[model samples]
Target: MMRVGVISDTHLRSYDRDLAKKLAEHFKDVQMILHAGDITELSVLDMLEAPQVIAVLGNMDGFAAAQSLPAKRELKLEGFQIGLIHGYGPPNGLEERVRREFDDVDAIVFGHSHKPTNYLLNGLLYFNPGSAAGGRGHPKTVGMLTLGDSISGEIIEI
Candidate 1:
């Protein structure tokens, strides 16, 4: 199985020591790391210990480090097509907006709501790892995606 660690909305200006420790402990076995955005600093990626890192630039990321990062991306992992987006506008219609943005994707990973979500809608998985920085009263969390014969995932609260 392929294990991918998913994180988002880490609005820290510098490396977060607690977050680094948590990642090292919990994501030791992950093959890849996905940052859904709002990562305020590019150094955050350098601090992670994953073999591969895939990310997008969120609305709040305006620095040079985030300048070249795409706003959206599509990747295939273990034969499943996954769409990555940082999201926009209000949270109420966020899912619909994402669905409209990508087609033929098995799963859509997004952030910006700072709320954890793991559910299937119209046969597509909608996952939001919440805010890894614990912003807006939401608990700090991340996600794990296991791909094998099929795709399965979980939102983990840190």
Candidate 2:
């Protein structure tokens, strides 16, 4: 199985070093890390410390940034087609949006709600890791996905 650490919505002027260190230590065996978006800056990605990091650029990202991040990205992990985006607003019609963006996805991960969630629908697992840096009345946290030809995730509070 491949353990992947997931984080999102870190809009702070500075990242929490302690949290990063702890995550690095606890997820040392993880094969990769993913940041859903609203990162605001490239330094946020540097703090993750995971060898492999997959991320998306949210509305808050500046143009002409060096990171070459995409607004959406589809990745094949193990045997699953996973799609990612930084979803804001209500969940209604959100699935359609994702489907339109990545119709063949087997799983989808998103953020921008600042509320953690995980659900299965139409055989698709939709997940939101919440705000790892904490704000807007949301708990600060991250996530982990243990995958091998399949996918599942656990929300981890930062």
Best by TM-score: 1
TM-scores of all models? 0.96, 0.87
- Judge candidate 1 against the unseen true structure and give its global Cα lDDT, from 0 to 1: 0.89
lDDT of 2 by residue, 9-121 (tens): 88755566887787787578888888888888776677777679988987666553326888888988888888988875565766556657778888888887777877787
By TM-score, how accurate is candidate 2? 0.87
Error of 1 at 93 (Å): 0.6
Clashes of each: 0, 0
Candidate 1, residues 13-112, lDDT tens digits: the string is 8887888999888789999999999988888887678889999999888586567799999999999999999999998999899888898999999999
Residue pairs with clashing backbones, model 2 = none
Q: For model 1, how many clashes? A: 0
